[model samples]
Target: MIVRGKDITGPLRESADVCIIGSGCGGGASAKILAEAGKKVILLEEGGYFTSRDFDGTEGFAYQTMYQRRAGQSTEDLSVTVLQGRCVGGSTTVNWMTSLRTPEFTLDDWRHRFGIEGLSAKDLDPYFERVERYLNVKAEPDENHNPNNRIILDGARALGYSTKANGRNARGCVRSGACGLGCPFDAKLSVALTYVPDAVKSGATVYADCRAEKIEGSGKTKRVAGYVLDNERRTTKTDFVIEAPVVIVSASAIHSPVLLLKSGVCNSSRQLGKNLTFHLTTAVAGRFERIIYPSGGIPQSAMCDEFLNKNGDNGGFWVEAVPVYPALAALAFPGFGRAHRERMREFPHTGASITLVKEIDSVGRVTVNDHGRASISYDPGPKDIEYLKQGVAAAARIHFAAGAKEVMTLHARPTIIRSEGEIERKIRAASWERNSLALFSAHPLGTCRMGNDPQNSVVDPHCQTHDVPGLFVIDGSVTPTSLGVNPQITLLGIAEKSAEWLAENFAAVAR
Candidate 1:
């Protein structure tokens, strides 16, 4: 049964065979698998549950209700905007639905470098196939590409760069271009619509608006203590606790480490809250003479991977188009009052494409502050910054190839390019300092990394924390290295693998 904490009359307590502390791709997958295996499962989510009817397709409503910290969460230095979901469906509800598998190179790195066993491409193929078939992951038709998405397709083709249509998870999508604001038509089959409900049907109890505060383990039983949140007021309404033999922490990379740090468990390696990576992202907007209407159709449908892993360095970046909403565009477009207003007036005629840089040398950390909230910090390596500059230049060139009249970068001072010749000089002159360029990361990973050595890693190849018996972490937090693509499918596959192991060894684990 699914229950909303706000609707509960008083403090509620329950015990189960397994307790999952999150409800995203990892937690949702685990809940369904474990429950179907005949183990009583309980899932806890800090965000409220909302369906298609509640998604109003407005930025104001979506941000205030579904996003983490009202879509304002950032690093300790306030340089990179960290976008994460804080709802029953987690990021699956808010993501653009561009589902991709973990790059084969990444999997190889995990196996050889990190000594992660039994997780090679051949081993994970069956799991990925299952998830793809269930979620309807497929590439959209060429006709479905809006002008914004076509920018990447047509421009890349003109420049002789290979481009491909992105495979999305939506079945009967209407191309509303509001995937980031939560799919209002239910066409996008997020975990909230697919796995969460299926888990409930399999007899798993899910509590929304209930945050897990700490996890305590004693001999054979584990206790999870938390408070029921008053969704509207953002205050604690009641306290609740659940005792079980197995506890799984599937919170995102940022929150998972913080929860473990706060609980004082799973830190024997001193690696619980380290090795953070964000697919560092920025955009280059181009002005077209014709109306592009970037906010109408599919938000992101095509991508150019020509630059990714270039020269076999395992670095570089990939390019995709971004959906331009009023509020987001205002913050992203360069310049002050009058200049910003002028740009907003031209929003209808502008097309923007963003680049996601896969971190090779950059490292970030996630820790807890005095108030027990997540405090994130990151410093990009010099090589990564150079990749960003190259990405910006390449995107600008693509825009020019697509016949854009003018192009602009999201730098604080702004680099404006009128002709193709200006792209290089202007981008090179722009500042690459922390606050100098507007940066964003929707994909945060690698905190609580997996490996063979207990002294160097927090979890083993099976995802069980080395320091805590019967405690496992099955989320993006467990990725030993950065994935060069969208990680939703990869996370689901990992959860499937781990949950299967847990179910097979339930009796031994429970003892």
Candidate 2:
């Protein structure tokens, strides 16, 4: 059953067959699968459980209530603004619902470079298919795209670039463009609406507003302690504990490692919070003469992966549509005072997109502060800096091809470009520094990576901690490398596969 703070008063303690932290993609998937196998699962989430009825359709209200730090979280250097969900479904409730499968090239690279076997795209095909079937994942028909989504297609086609309709994990989407705030219509089938509920049906207990403080025991023991956060009261005073034979840390990459380090569960390797990958991203918005309600329909409708993996080793970047609203667009579009104000006024006529670099060269780290808050630091590699410039230039070209009157980049001086020839020249001249442009990171992964070597990785191929036998990290943190696409599908696939394996071997392992 879904248990909230109101259901309990003061401190509490509980025990379970398995304790899963952070009810997002990985935790939600694992909870459902393990519970279905008759395991008593306790799913812990720091965020509250809310439904469509709870969404008010206001960006400000949603951000303050549903997003991490009211969606204003940034890195240690403030170079990258991180947006992560804080509610029951985790990011699944807030993501754009673009369900792209892990690229085969990415999987192959992980297998060979990171020694992560049993993770090939072929090996994950069945899990991906199952998840798609469960979520009703389907490609939005050409005619179904909103004007904003259509711009990506129109621009790509005009430039003779290969583009594909993005697959979304929803049924009968109303195209409300509110996925970032949380799907108000239930058209966007987040994990809360699908897997989490299925988990509840299997008699799993979900504790919302219960933030996990840490996994208490060291080495092989599984004991978790945390407190309940009452949003209405703005207090996290109540204490709670969960003891299980198996403890799964499915918190996102940034928080998972921090949680581990604080709890002192397994740090023998000290590889807990290293190698963070963000799919480092920046945006470019184009102004068109024709009115384009970019925020009215589905966001992220199309993807141009023509530039991706061209090097044959699965590295490059892609330009994809960013479902832009006035508040977000204003923030993402670089400018200030009158310049920014005038641009938002043309919100109706602007088509916006972001260039996502599959960053690898500039590795980042996640460390906790004195207050145990996460602090992220990333420095871009020299080559990746060039890649970002090229990607933005390409996006500008696509917009120009699609009849954009003008285009704006996140650069400092030569921010706005009117002609195609200026795209590269201006961007090339721009300084390659952190936060040079308005940078955003929705996907934070590879913090607690998986590999065969104990020296370099936290988890094994089975997703269990190398130093702590009963501890497992079934989230994006375990991914060995950066995924060039949206990471929801990839994370769910891994969790599903890991849960199935645990179900089959639980009895033997428990003995």
Candidate 3:
């Protein structure tokens, strides 16, 4: 049921009961649920499919084949780097496999503040449990904790910080310490290896390298129009038409709204690409005396959420170890030339952790250019900068507690910290602006938020567009606010619940 779109010649037109325009976590979950419901579903991906053999664990090759714009997608100011996956499995394929449920706080806020209805943490528990079962989610046992992860736990405990164990979607994981580059051993169970295959077995067809360009028609008579790209040269090889009564857009936060705007659908609220929120994150690396091989163990095993919401509900941040790899770690370090080189020399001794703050007041927007490509114009909330300083200071204190000799940050002048007392002083002195500390985010959300009102939201509680009857968006883009933790599990649970609704009411919604 899986086909390389490039292999198909001429105009490849197809019809289906439903069409899903993405193959990541949301789309994959939808495909599995709808297909099992006996709907003739077609799942399309803009990137080519690759197996464990295709992954060599190299940054260059991984970026080239798997990342969005070769992993160079950034803000208009080139300040924040958005690392989104552009493959069949989407970000889940390249993510560190850290899976966590949506916190009750986030879900409750959505219902109370955003007018979003019919779902709560209690309502989503079954869906969360289902996706966890399907993806082989498991907690890292204490006996097998990796050194880098151990550092996070030990450091947080020493400072009396409440640490949370990260549950990952891995079954027979080999502990290769390189999940970001794609799991070569087929151990880290991405959606590609779990949900997609199950979907295929239930009669869903996945066309890799097949991009959904624009949807045609409106209301109940919706259709998806797109083309398949050549996997080798990355060019359009053939045009494809997927006629369906129901068309779903599950592209990521940035691109989902771009697709809607380009297609001229679902813009009644004029909020298609507004309220973009990224968990603004910054990592602080410490130099330890022991050779811990930070790059050789689980990337994220522990997290400290003690400071989350510490600043009075403007949204807070969580601290965790950055899954370490040489190329990525080196590039993320501050400065270039001699200082950078010397830092890499101490790579073996470097144990780093990052603070990811959930953003709610960002004036960020995702706009499309003349070519219809997605571009980011985001400015982090002012309060978020103060929160980042507090989180960075906390990370520094933890490293010092765990016996780190010195710690380095993304600041310009006082980039390194040798004592615990300077953590607060140096952080307060530096300007907490974008690019001040090499900030990175795996979670980008809220480009097309869901709510009960069409004036303020793009989708209804069921994830269907308020303006377009047959058009739906089921992805990170539909989240009303940024979750304070990893988002794959939340999106998956939402997709599953939405798919259930779509299946039961297919006759009523889809003409």
Candidate 4:
């Protein structure tokens, strides 16, 4: 039922009730929900379907096979790192399986600031419950903790900071900190193993390795009409226009905006690619006298939300425990050649966690090139730099409290502090003036934000484009602001709710 490659040729040549793009968490979840409702669906993914056997537990090959723009190719300038998955399951296939719901505060902010109605926690609870049920979301019990996870717990307890087990979509995970490398044991519950399959079983057709070139349509009478697909070997046109009155764009925050621009829809607001927010993260590594293989446990078993509620004026930052693999650690280390190699050899004795700073009102743009590829332009704002410095100082303190022999900050200066007081002083003195730190983003939001007013937002509160009928964007592209947490679960919840709304309203709109 999960047709791929050659199997898509004939089916895509025909029409369906709805066509959804990008079979990631949002798309996959939407497909399953709509298909189960007995609607004909066709899901298109630009990448191939890769299983556990295809994952080699290495960074290079996985990047080539599963990642979009390749592993290291995509970046906004050389300083800001951007990573996105490009497989049939999209980023869900390669992402860490941590699942956290959008915070209530964020929902409230959307209601108050954007005038978005019916987005409160109470209204969304049902959708969250349904998503959690399908994902089998649960916290990591004590037995699941590994050295990497325990260190985080010990640090939090020692510092009088709060910590809680993180909810992840997994079962029988043996604590193998390889979630970033693609879960080899098939324990990680990604969409490839969940909704995508469910959609197939419910008779939805899936097409992989098919890159959608352009969405053909015009004005409020738009219908997507068809798409030009290229699979390297051949290029063809699928003019299968659906009689149904809906088209769902579930592409990620980055690509969805680019698609809209290419299609000449929602361009009036000019907000399709503005307001990009990346939960900017940096790591702190410490050396322990005892051997602690951080990679021997579940990748992310716990997190500290002690600062999650810090007032916006107070420069709030969110810190979470993260396991680092040797290769990734080396990339983050602030040294060259011999020093870096020596540090890499001590990977077994290193413990690290990343701190994500909720940035200020920083704005970025996503632009498509003549070749139809998406490129991002952004730089951290001044307030964001201050927040990063505060977060780095805090992360250093946590490691020192955990009985670290020495702590290393992931900055250009590479300050190594042995005592708690020195950690604070050195981190404070560290300069973020030049944007020298190795910065990366896992969550990208607000590219095509939603609001009640069409003048300020690309999409309406119901996720429909202001200038285009029969078009809806049901992914992170519609996030009005950063949720300051992993967005995969929240995106699924939104997609589920939006799909239901579309299903109920589609016939009325069609008439």
Q: Best TM-score goes to which candidate?
A: 1
* Residue lDDT tens for model 3, 1-511: 9998767878888889889998898899999999999999999999889899999988888889999989889888878889999888999999988899998888888999987777898899999998898888888889667767777788889989898688999988878886888889999889899889989999999999998889998655567888889867977888899988998898889899999999887888999999898898888889999987887767777788798766558487888888767877776888888978888899889888888888866677898988889989889777777677778888888889888999988664437889997787777777766666677778999999999989999999999999888788999999999899899999999999999999999999986
Give the winner by lDDT.
Answer: 1
The deviation in Å at residue 235 for candidate 3 is: 1.8
TM-score of 1: 0.99
Question: Global lDDT for candidate 1?
Answer: 0.92
Task: Score every model by TM-score.
Answer: 0.99, 0.98, 0.98, 0.93
> lDDT per residue, candidate 4, 278-390, as tens digits?
88788788899888787777888787777765765533576677777666777888878888889888899998888887666566678888777788877778777777777
Alpha-carbon lDDT, every model: 0.92, 0.87, 0.86, 0.77
Residue by residue across 258-363, what tens digits does model 1's lDDT show? 9999999999999988999999999999999988988889998999999988857778898999999999999888888888899899988999999999889997
Give per-model CA RMSD.
0.9, 1.3, 1.3, 2.6
What does candidate 2's lDDT look like per residue over 147-256, in tens digits? 87777798889889999898899887887788888888999889999999999999999999998887876433478998888876778868998988889999899889
Error of 2 at 77 (Å): 1.5
